[model samples]
Target: MDILYLMILCSASLAAVFLIIFIVNAKKGQFEDDESPAVRILFDSGEIKEKENNGNKKDEKEIGENNKIEEKSE
Candidate 1:
């Protein structure tokens, strides 16, 4: 009875705090440009050149080399 009331009050206070913070930050434009991260990865990094120029095929070459190096130690 009293415990349930205390728990509800505590949760309501926490929710109010979070809601206020969210509204304040939202008005300040903190989340305005959310799409930038998902779009940014579409651009190339230097790894594409290594894969193309050497026919290195990064995924297979990297995994194979790592396995070979580990095996040599035993």
Candidate 2:
């Protein structure tokens, strides 16, 4: 029927629109750095560890100050 033809035309146009968007994104480098994102967690974890190490130093300093305060109070 004519309805089938209309449905086919609508689906084809929708597919074309999606394909164009995909092509534009691909050309604009949207998919170029796919590998970095996957490996980013590995590198990011090292940076987090470094930050945690730095934070620990501050915590130790605070603890030392607390001990000094306790000694003074006693």
Please tell me which predicted candidate would have the highest TM-score against the true structure.
Answer: 2
| Model 1 lDDT tens row, 1-55 | 9999999999999999999999999999999999988998977565764466467
Deviating ranges (above 4 Å) for candidate 2: 45-58, 61-74
- lDDT to native, each model: 0.81, 0.78
Backbone clashes in candidate 1 total 0
Residue 25 C-alpha lDDT in model 2: 97
Tens digits of per-residue lDDT for model 2 on 1-74?
99999999999999999999999999998999878888876543546545666677567777677657756966
Q: Which pairs, if any, clash in model 2?
A: none
RMSD of each: 11.9, 10.6
Clashes within 3 Å, all models in order: 0, 0
Cα shift from native, residue 52, model 2 (Å):
6.3
Off by over 4 Å in 1: 45-74
Tell me the lDDT of model 2 at 11.
100
